[model samples]
Target: MAADRLSALPDDLLQHILSFAPEREAAASAVLSRRWRTLWRRESALDLDIRPYMAADEGQDLRNSPSPLDALLSDAVAALAAFPRRGGGTVLKRLTLFLDLNDVDSSYDSVDDPEPVDDGRVAGLLADPAAAGLEEVLIGCEHGRMRTTTYGLPLASMACAATLRVLELESCNFEPPLSPRRAFPCLTELRLRHCFFKEGCLQAMVDAAPALTSLSLDRVSQQPPDSAFQAMPAYCWVPFRLRCLTATTLELKTYSVGAEEEDLARIGIELDMPSLRYFRYTGDAIKLSLASPAPGLSSVDLNASLRGEQSQWEPTSRMLVSFSSTRALKLHVNCMNDIIYGEEEHGGAILPTFPNLKLLELDEFFEYTSSSAALAMARLLRSCPVMSELRLNLNMTRWYRDDEPKTNDPARSPFAQSMDRFNRLASMTASSRRVSELPAVLTDDGAFTCLQTSLRKVTLQFNANELDCFQVQLAKFLVENAMVLEEMHVDDGNTFWLDHLCNKLERWRADSFRRRNLTDTARFRVHHLE
Candidate 1:
């Protein structure tokens, strides 16, 4: 440069500029000049990923002691210690570590290897002097073998607690904190996935983060109920009960519904976040108790494993009452059907009206199967008077002929029954194709207010090679009834046969415009797989 102006900039400003570059590029800048020789060492962020250093060829072995990645990790930790402190701490403000601890050591060669992989080397990185100034931290481990041997999070010794604002930990075991006081006073967002907690440890950890605004816990479970303690009824099992006064967004997902019924029944979720706006729950539909009404709640996404049982129906109705104030909702097809059928089973409790609902998405939907399901769908549409958008994922695999026998065997496993029904449907797909008659409830011209007034956009997704007969009927009904419809999007999952599907849609769109006496005003588009 003519005046060497770049080197004249302050150290802090230069470090802040280098923070946006990749770690390797930032480190390589040291050779540019004398002023930049030690500048990269004090950059405010570090993101170290071990996957690139992993040697896939047979010549390089990862199991050897002091492997290349292991040595690099050690060197990085040592380098962090050498950074001079400014304002009582180093300038590092963000740190991320992506680790694969599955085959890190040669000792883990056999299934019954007595030696456990040492996690202290990874934990030591956080103990560095640079971590005291960290504002955001993310540590994620590989999912497969790492699930069995999880990294124990050493929160008690972490120096970033006072300054951290965001923390995300995946595939780690939580160690109970040494104190009950707040550990992350300023943390606003916390996400824990595939983590295990003992009885009281989860609540303690949540209570420590008093300022959290967004929280997510996926597949976080306590120890399974002991089989030998048959007489105890699993009372020692602590339900996930919390009363976060500050959180506005929450997502909770559980393991699959293979656990024993008693264990499932004992796993209750109780939340008292009065300020909550968005909530999503995906798992077996267990007991949900909301202690306070959330008047500000805007969106809800509930994906529950449902069955034809009275116990499941009543609880679901109570859940609907809790979400009466939401403006947007997403549900599975069974959930939509069960809303009416479930309330009928529970002594015809008056269904709550979604006065503010605008958008609704129904996944795994089968169009107009049985009269009860049709009636349920009609009632649901009638409730959302102001709904503007509707999305349906047409599940063609569940379609069957009218002459097939219905199977409701309780003793047989659900998976086996599903596979059997799928095989039957596959065999009859080509031969038993017939156009289905529209349900009388849906055909009623004035039954659905949303369709007549507010419904504007409709989206349909078909994953099967051939569209079901009822799917076509449903499309025609929407085009005829939705008076204010703006656009219809058809997303077909069959890649090779997209042209065939598009041709069908084109003919239908032309026919729809003629039926409505409108000339090319509606927008109909087909989305093909890339």
Candidate 2:
């Protein structure tokens, strides 16, 4: 080569290559070539994570660590100060700063009013004029046990909110901007997890962000908005704005076991998302309500926990019908059977039929083998009209669709209704039921409808240590009932021990059966109990 290929590239291209790389890898790039040495310093993003290093050394306690002007804070401050002051080619586009706190006074002063956080070095960087072009910023911290701690970050210190596109803060308290000014205009995405806002600042920031497209409020504080704020005006209808929201992705998780549930009122009681595509909720099922039908939703994950008294809560399957249009759903609840079957724990309200569901995951699936569980499960199986894939957590049982169709049992009467159609010759004396009896039952029987589709896969979780009759029966039932199954993958998760035992049992059976016959020429085939 006439010249080195790396040295021939312009400075701008090299800076981009370094900008996209991780902070550690970018530091290592200096050894590649002399020209690439200083290019990392000129990159557009500065993502510095010093938490691991600090956690490893374990030498400096929070009360005794070097001041923000001396340690990790100083490095961040210096990096911002030296970030290219030339004719303006590449400015700071993104900044991510992560820190860990081992104690309450982790190198920052403790205050009671605004927040308990202290980072003078970050404040110093924000005050510098070089940070005026910053577009995105994420400041996250980790406490010992994820305990709530408010960080004192003055909005006035950050002068780049007008240009900021994404802002995410965790374990901190954020104060709104001062009066006689607008707030975060170009912001598109905002994620607040375990963060606190000053009085009235929460609603003010929501009203000010004119271009927000994605918002996630996971366990956000329940503090009421301030009645008097010098910087922002009031909205008479805040819930309506949330109902008519246009964001594409929204995640809401609430943990109301603390005093906030008793003191603070619930905000945004009904979700009015029309443009939502993905959703996840993980706490307190009794708190959610649908403002209108969410026709655009496609994915949902519900980690439901019942709080307060079950008698006071209306366990209506109707609330979940809003998500009938979803393509995938993961449900983790202890009382799901109660909702599906409308038992004594929950009112006897049958869930509506879902015509668009494809993949359904029922967490704690092995618990559905008891009389109550089986009855509830039968009801659920009869409601998913178009479901194709079902994931269950099976702990070694030979249970199948028809293993114990307890038609005589009062609890299993709903299932007997579906099985009756398959065995209609035994039930109806006229050879066929009247025309009207067919539609009301067949049109609503999901188990009968599932057999008509292209259900080809049955995946089960089992164990080698506890093989039972249900394991074999489930496979037989799927092969016979599904009618079009092509694959049945069982993940025993114990390294094929069950398969080994099945082989040993099969060999033993064959030997014992062959010994019983007087003739050695007699051919024998043996089936294992497993």
Candidate 3:
């Protein structure tokens, strides 16, 4: 025996080590020795993933009997019941449970028959004495694709509201507590994804969680306005107002509604987070408005399409103005459609100057063939006077290239004709018109302070076998113009043309130095994306 040094460690430390293992494996450690038998029972963290224990459903028929999912749930409840009680006992600090029922064929099964696993039993875990001081809980459920019902989590049954600090729930109906006061008194972080809220449940939950500092709502929706619950008091639907005073970081994404409800959805968003420092929003349309300026907000990322309705441009303009104080900014290509076309239509500046911005990242989803993209790039460069780094992600998928060899095989005629039609449509819809010359913002002397002095690093990402002419021109323009640039990185996401791409980039480096009348000190390199 090596003096059993590991066993000599403190009991709490040993339990902490065991907590990382699966619950069943951790409990199995009890058979090792007398000292270890009870140590696993006192562990403070539990991760109950029922996927491994689920029996194979390939050939088994579960129509008449309770599902393995139900069995696992019962086993989990029994395990929780075995933990030590409240007074002077070990307090569970964290619990994470993941239940996936995508393989089960339970669409036609009646809820009254097998008494679909009571959601309250899972929520009641918080009421157990073992969870007296529980601080974190993550519950994720993926129901069968064919099933019509969703799990309804009973929020009122949670008993660790005063001590809980973090909570996350996914794919469920969030039922608000009966009383809002003192609910989730100590909670500081909350995330809800793919969830449905009752008429006013979300508002009440927000009102109750006063100490919350971070919140994320992804694909969260509510029932239609015609629900039976709205019959009382002649319930009039209102825009979802998220008025968090203490939250410093917030994310709202994909707030989608039907076309008939588009006007209501666009009515507006009310945000009152005075201390916010970081904000990221992703959607196809605009629906956000801050109640007041967040003086402390410093970083913002906006990912939305601004090409459709004129109504979206004004709100986007207002949003950019509010984010003028931010130091870092990222914009998707769809966002530039509005700024570029709006500037063309209105013949004026459609964006505010980002005086404080030091870093800028632009994301593109298609091949860059028109000068509208160049103009958009120029306008952004001119706005950020002191930006030091620039990143361009040209995630090109497919496009028409006239230089490529044409196919003449009769067997591929149908597919080739269809692709040619698609190529034409993409080109026509890409921009209303095209121009030959680079925008004056790039050609004129002293037009951009960032390019003249401050800009030091540049990164361009491409995902194609060959670079588009527009892409090559943009790269050449940047290399020849950025006087103080020290490093230029080209991420080659191509599969078969790595060697060709590398050689072409080398030539660009030589040509840029020769054109600029400067020494080429190996300032650029090409990297392959794995």
Candidate 4:
């Protein structure tokens, strides 16, 4: 009955159904009945996963016999070749092969040098003019090394399929002198992950694909030259009209002006794309500048780490000025401490001004004095007139105090009297009085109130025990300012003030009951972990 139902479906629908099944299962389905025998062959998209097939053939001791890896590769190539061609001679729309070639622990010797698998049979299939109609190809394999002479995909044998648009290669290698010369004029998207190329091979590949629009390169390395470091050529002058680019672990040894110039020149070079928005670099810091401003860019993430006796402080600071159009910016400065306080320091005033900026996050390794921090905050608030959110994650673990006391230190007296003075100061500060209005001795409470008004949400994830007096003052300020606040979450872990907070929230608004009722039916729970 199941077979009958499957057969009743239209040819297109049946093909779609069979495409979802594994290659082995799809092939086995043919034996279900006569009508289903050729159904799998009609699938336009072929997905062959070799791991399960290899694992199921456990009884075949090919290790002590002929090479199992070679046999497996041969079987896969043969299966693809056996697929029937369409009336117009087209093979398939797409072909995806996912393989896991990791060696089992059963062997003591290294399997790195597994016998070479001849891909001539597969190359012959790809070379066929009828099979050239394939539009997309994805190949993913496990971690392994390919010989310098062994090319995984034979470009010479591959027919120029104008229909091919997308190609992805993961954990694969291309042999040296890999000049395929075949132009993928219609190809737009190319992704290469954990793949290696011979020197000048990448440039050659990029030159062949003029229509490339989106390119993702991750963990791609080139063979080192005798000079130790040499700048690789910028292959894509205008890669397939590329608009989105993500590059990681691009190892370049030499620093050349053209390398930087070419990179910056292509900032807003897209001719066909208006939605090209993201530009992300997660590896080594490249000294590339923006050519034409990226006025359309909404967000930019730049992570740069440079090595040198001289500081990259000035150059980095200057580079930021180019990204004036970005509304959201995340910058990770590697040598922040060294550069910020160096002898020839470019003043912190060099920090870029975000005119239309609303959200800002600063992750720094610096000790921020209360006065310095306040000044910096004032400048930012003044600059970003519409700013609504600010997050500062600082590492202040190394702050130390001098043994010599300041002039304002309390007299060496009873502990209770000293505590009384401190509490009084806290209370005065948390009262929200103007900075000029602060008395000769400011209270901790007055200081807390002043900070509370500027922040909608403030989270302190460090030790609060040392700032107990300040915490108490801040808690009182929260209670008083509860009307202006929409949400107040305090995670002091010191339960001494939790009850006070709960009571304050309960009495401040009767809407708390409404929130409790809504919580019962909500699918998502906002957990406040203690």
TM-score of each: 0.73, 0.69, 0.77, 0.58
Order of the predicted models by TM-score, top scorer first: 3, 1, 2, 4
Q: Write the per-residue lDDT of candidate 4 for residues 1-530, one digit (tens) a residue.
A: 24556557886788788877767788898888787787777777777776676676688776575344455556666666665543334367777776554543222222122222334544454566545778887877666443211225555556644677887876455553334556677777777765556555665665566676566766454443324233433122211122222221121122222333333322312222233355554533443445455566666566554445333323444445666556665555543442232324544455456665545555444332333333333433444444444444433324422321222334645555445445544654433322121112222223322233333433322222223223333344333332333444444333223233334433423443354452212111111326
Best-to-worst lDDT order? 1, 3, 2, 4
lDDT of 3 by residue, 1-530 (tens): 46878788998789889988778889899888999888887888788876765655445676765566676677667766666652346677888888775554444332212222344566667667666677998877765653323456667767777888999987666677876564888999989876667666776787788899999887666543455433222211225577788888988776444344455555545688888889888765455667777888778888766544565334454457667777888876453445455565556766778888888888865434555566667778888999998988865434543444343335768677457434543554323222123566567646888987788888887643333445555666776677777777776543223233445655666776787688755365554434
Write the residue-wise lDDT of candidate 1 on 98-181 in tens digits: 766675543433212212354666556777766888899887777564354456666676788888899888756666777766
Model 3 clash pairs are none
lDDT of 2: 0.57
Summarize candidate 2's per-residue lDDT along 1-530 as a digit string, tens digits.
37777677898888877776657678788898777777786788877776645655476675766643246667777777777653357688887877664443543332223245555455556656777788887877775553555556667678677798998877666666686376778988988877666555665676677677688886665343454422222211112124435666777776544323322213324676767778887665443566666777778887765555554333435446667677777777655443553355445544667777777776643332443444444555566667777765544223532353333345756556446434533444442321111122222445556655645455555442222333333443444345444444555432223233324432433443456562322232222222
Candidate 4 overall lDDT versus native: 0.47
Q: How far is candidate 1 from the true structure (C-alpha RMSD, Å)?
A: 8.7
Best by TM-score: 3
Deviation in angstroms for 506 in model 2?
18
Q: In candidate 1, how many Å is residue 172 off?
A: 2.2
In every candidate, how many clashes are there? Answer: 0, 8, 0, 17
Off by over 4 Å in 3: 1-10, 32-35, 56-65, 85-88, 101-119, 143-148, 223-238, 306-319, 334-341, 344-347, 366-368, 395-397, 401-441, 464-468, 492-530
> Top lDDT: which candidate number?
1
lDDT of each: 0.67, 0.57, 0.66, 0.47
Write down the worst ten-residue block by lDDT for model 4. 247-256
Any residue pairs clashing in model 2, and if so which? 151-173, 200-226, 397-470, 397-471, 398-469, 398-470, 398-471, 399-470
